[model samples]
Target: MNASVDTAGAMAPQDVVNLARYPIGDPDSPERAALVKSLRDYLDEHQYVALPDFILPNARSRAVTEIDAVSHEANHNSSFRNCYLSRVKNPSLPEDHPINIFEDTSNWILAYDQLPDSSPLKTLYHWDAVREFVAEIVGEDRLYDNEDPYQPVNVLIYNDGDRSSWHFDSVNAFTVTLMLQAPEAGGDFELVPNLREGELDNPDGIRAVLEGKGETPVPVAREPGALCIFRGCTALHRVAPVKGATQRLMAVMVYEDQPGVVGRPDVNETIFGPRVAANG
Candidate 1:
């Protein structure tokens, strides 16, 4: 899996990833094997893992430049919703119920189709070794790139004051992301692990947190060029409000369990904004 011998259509590992440290391209190397095992162990224990400098700094800069050129076109969304993603209050429930608590969230996103072909983001995502390495870390036999035109990859942009509200992913699965840029302050990621890991519901724990009376979820810091794998499904997580002038950018990569999977039109429209919604 050396860069010189990479087959057609695959990006050179060193071009995007720091192979000297991670050695993702060298599958047989003991260092790579141990790295995967340690990553898996950490994820198994914390339901999340982040590898600093997973992407080369220069490549990250290029990806940022590419995004800045199209920043004006990024899809913008701002809304107030409960963890369940419902904007309306549940009148049937008490006013102080978790369902009645709404939180503010805002951000912009660049869909996969919007990125230019020269984007290093695409190069890293297109690399099979990257996907295979992710599979190993997540304990999956294999992972397939999402076939959807707009969902396969995306750059999540968080400007000053932007944040995501505490919420659980509707579906239970792993989400992969790479940090391209980080805000000067705030924009911290907080996770409350296993909030609803199984059918069992920890109402007291969830209700306490929603009421701001529970244990504070520790913030996880990820620097630029870091790759993060998170099991946010069933876990209440959120990004704190960003501060300062620097924008926080994270590349979210989608990997499906099955092949040929595309996004649902209605949901896709909600995430990708009017551009894809109009064309789709």
Candidate 2:
């Protein structure tokens, strides 16, 4: 039942070391062609891609465990709201461009600088594996390049109830969600794709949903052990109320335009407590 040991019962203790314990990708096996092909097709035509056994089977189990632990540790009595974003230092674009305009309140959580390599919940935003897959689908030569070469990775965990509202992520490219655990009911991920390029820009789409001015967002039910990859930058999405005692758990790996970038610090401290710097 131990993650570190292989099938033969050989004790390889280091094999199970968390994110920091191991490198992001194995350069020797640089690309998984079959995986890239299928993933590319899924991303091209659909708003989301579901990858089974995406993580090492053992690692997936670990992720599930960590997610449950965080949910149990949740301040249930604490204010239940919608979505939590990784904290950044300067959330205000200009001196006073309505900081409240960007304010998001979805029952959620953050695992930014606070989690360590040892923490299974730490967001591993490694771009190598994802970039390769994306490049294959979007055509590396055609996709938009990140100004920064080495992109920073961050993981997001959501534990919300009926109050979890609809919203969109600021990052504009593909967003990866690895389902570590599934809720019994509700908790479906609904999306309004191409909002970035369509008549519905994110701000307006979110506003429409909040104001009840438009139709309901499209729904995408994510199952445990399935990788949910979607273009969320502009798309409006939300986690419907999580029913049953078991909370929904997902390992969200996100890439940023700027590596090592942190979202609003005050927000981070407010929700997940103080930030803990990751060891480079």
Candidate 3:
């Protein structure tokens, strides 16, 4: 579909996305086609793709400001989690076992439902062009935002000393994140590609990563306003602790293969809060 204006008269995809830098709205454009092909190929080979300055600088600055202004409202949570990104403990295993090692931490999150309509990040998430472009690059027919309002979008914040522990995604096939701000030190994203594909039990490999004894994991360059597409289900990854007083901010866009499917109630309550309501 051609780009359309939203209620505020901003271009559906253009106002938010830097089309000249990344022509995701117009698939027929040669630049768009080439960009999609290259990104897909890179993701296929490396299990993730990073596009620096995916959002224009001015718009990105606005997003950062908005998120910062609302930082006080963010819900902060932390807990110990295993490599599977779950809090469940296998009591039968020894404490030192990778399956039993739960050292993951959490960061603050502002769910989509909490974002106002004027939020640039929220508007961008609802754009058809953006969704279509991501689907094409990920080799999916199309992508659907989660029916659960809170699950579809989020602003992940990493304050000083905050970090996401090493783990894999539990549900989504892929994750699309845009960095809005970077701390002065740390908050690096590290990934081990294809670490446990097709294997249910890869304790040795998991333990190696947890123990920091495996092959050197790839460290993704930190670029504010960059869009990162990660195949989290296949690649084990984590966000290093934020070191400085500055907070790290990112917008995480969640998509689903099926339509009208919201996140489970329990998951919603766990991530957001009890006041969370279903999108429908």
- Return the TM-score for each candidate structure: 0.92, 0.60, 0.92
Candidate 3 has a TM-score of 0.92
Among the numbered candidates, top TM-score falls to 1
Candidate 3 lDDT over 36-85, as tens digits, reads 99999999999999989778877788778778787888887798998887
The candidate that wins on lDDT is 1
How do the residues 1-280 of candidate 1 rate in per-residue lDDT, one tens digit apiece? Answer: 1244224543455788888888888778898899999999999988888899988888889889889999889988889998877799979988877788899999999998788765788778878889999999998998888878788889999999999998877753898889899999999988887777666767678778877788688577699999989897767889999998999999999888887889888888898887766795
The lDDT for every candidate, in the order shown, is 0.84, 0.49, 0.82
Clashing pairs in 1: none
User: How many pairs of residues collide in each model?
Assistant: 0, 17, 0
Kindly list the per-residue Cα lDDT of model 2 for residues 1-280, writing each as its tens digit.
Answer: 2233133432132233232322324534434555566667867766666665444446556656554554534322234333224323345454222222333434544353323334433322323444445555544533322322112222344444543455556555667777767777777888766655643344445455655565567777566656677877656676667777665666655444443444454533454543322221
Model 1 TM-score?
A: 0.92
Which scores greater on lDDT, model 2 or model 3?
3
Off by over 4 Å in 3: 1-12, 277-280
